[model samples]
Target: MKRRDLVIAALIVGGLVLASAVAVARLAGDPVGLLTRDAAASAGLPPYTGVISTFTVMVWFAAGTLSAFIAWTDGKHRRRLAPFAYLLLALAADDALLLHESVGPRLGIHELLIYAVYGLGALRIAYLMLGEERIVALAFWTGAALLAISVLVDVAFLGAYLLEDGAKLLGVLVWSTVPLLAHSAPRAAVPVLGLDRALEHRSQPG
Candidate 1:
């Protein structure tokens, strides 16, 4: 890889660190904030909003974006990445639609839609990364499958009877699987993260 590529990788990963720190700092003691928003609303009140934690939210957004970027850039030059690109764009767009609102049982249009887009994006990326290598592919698929199943459960199977059982698991899984899935593609970029394979291949003793 060129020196510039290393710089870009460092910057992208550095952004992850910065975003996570912001999230940790700002979301601190605010786990209940979303719930609080809803609780207040029950009594006919306005939502109690907090200072926008760009890092907290943007960290995940950046992670997803970086993963997609790697897949697209690499796939375009070496591997068809149009689908992956579209999904990445979808994930970023969905992030913009986040409401951070309090709700009963995680049932809200914004929440559902964001997670649905996230899951779809994840699955698509996982599929793209499926043949990269054994261990890496397994991890990626596991995350994607969990998230896709979770969303399907919530969106398609959710109803009065299944509501209690279905949505709970689905909602929980969606949030959990996303970060795992988001990190998978970037992990696949490990080999290319440093050495330019094109150069390394030519330089190898024949």
Candidate 2:
């Protein structure tokens, strides 16, 4: 990455860390009630879990947008990329709006829809990653596995809301790596980009 990009990333990471620290301090029974739970409630803020979830949603949305832009403009594996991009975008939307929670319950299919979306997305990503090197594929699959586990934790540990949300947040952080790694790889190395050669050659001389 360029120096400017690195600087921006550092800034964002720093801000998130600071925000998390503040949230944690506030949640840890601070008697002063500085950024307290009651304050958060009154101000319509989401405290710690909300901060993490918001970051997750933003990252997913950005990943989706970047993937879609790559799919549209890149010469290789555009068709395969479309699905991953759409999935990320869908995930981001769901996280931001609680779409599944609102709509699925009304339709009496909450679990089914969540499982279907996430499961299919993970499977599709795995299938696409087969073209990558073994290590890359392994890393992505691991993230996918963690993502599934996070959802399970969310369901199984509902009584422990903090643990459930933390697990889910951890999974999201891991899953965020897949797209970043994929983006770093060369476009020419993509397995399904054979057709891209003809297009590239069309622009060059023998």
Candidate 3:
């Protein structure tokens, strides 16, 4: 790896370690228990209980990592892929932390409001992905449709864990393919708002 990449990785690891130490100190908990233990172990539940959720979180994280790597290296589509990376990372954090289910409710934020924010973020991603490769866009939309079905089941049925989580898992699986598809596709020039034109005008001799 390049020196710059190694430095970036070290900084990120250091920041995470520092943050975890601070959290453990303030929370008055064992660092391992608080930071390293699985949710099932912490809650005294069977390991299998969180297996699927853990898998889903891993998939989201992997996709986010891939998207961030692509965005960092691919300047031609950085504007589009950077936001996509951020969205994926946020989604992974939300799912892994149960922010919507536990943290949001405890903070007096409505679940629907949290979902609305996520929906808006997803819409923004869709808008950004516009004019990209058709196959990549199609995969994203398919994943989105599956997620929509999952959300619908969550809101309407509430008891259908199999259907809700099944759709969600399928959606995550489909969504994880986006970065790979995008990486393999040929880069296309995407226009930014008047920036190119402004640069062109500035280049002309007075």
**Which of the two candidates, 2 or 3, achieves a greater lDDT against the reference?**
3
Candidate 3 residue lDDT tens string, 1-206: 78799899989999998787778767785655456667678888987996877888898889888889888987745666788888888889998988988999999998789889989988977766664567777788899999889888988898898888889889989988887787787655332332434544553599
- Candidate order by lDDT, decreasing, is 3, 2, 1
Task: Give the CA lDDT, 0 to 100, for residue 83 in model 2.
Answer: 79
Worst 10 residues of 1 by lDDT: 49-58
Q: List the candidates' TM-scores in order.
A: 0.35, 0.61, 0.80
Clashing pairs in 1: 1-195, 1-196
Q: What do the candidate models score in CA lDDT, each in turn?
A: 0.47, 0.66, 0.80
Comparing 2 with 3 on TM-score, the higher-scoring candidate is 3
- Tell me the alpha-carbon RMSD of every candidate: 12.1, 10.0, 4.9
Question: Model 3 compared with the native: what TM-score?
Answer: 0.80
Best by lDDT: 3
| Overall local distance difference test of candidate 2 | 0.66
Residue range 1-206, candidate 1, lDDT tens digits: 78799899999998886676567657685553443334446656555531132222344355445555655555422231345445544543443443322331256456665575556665655554543434444544554554456456555665533443343233333333333443354544543223335544653589
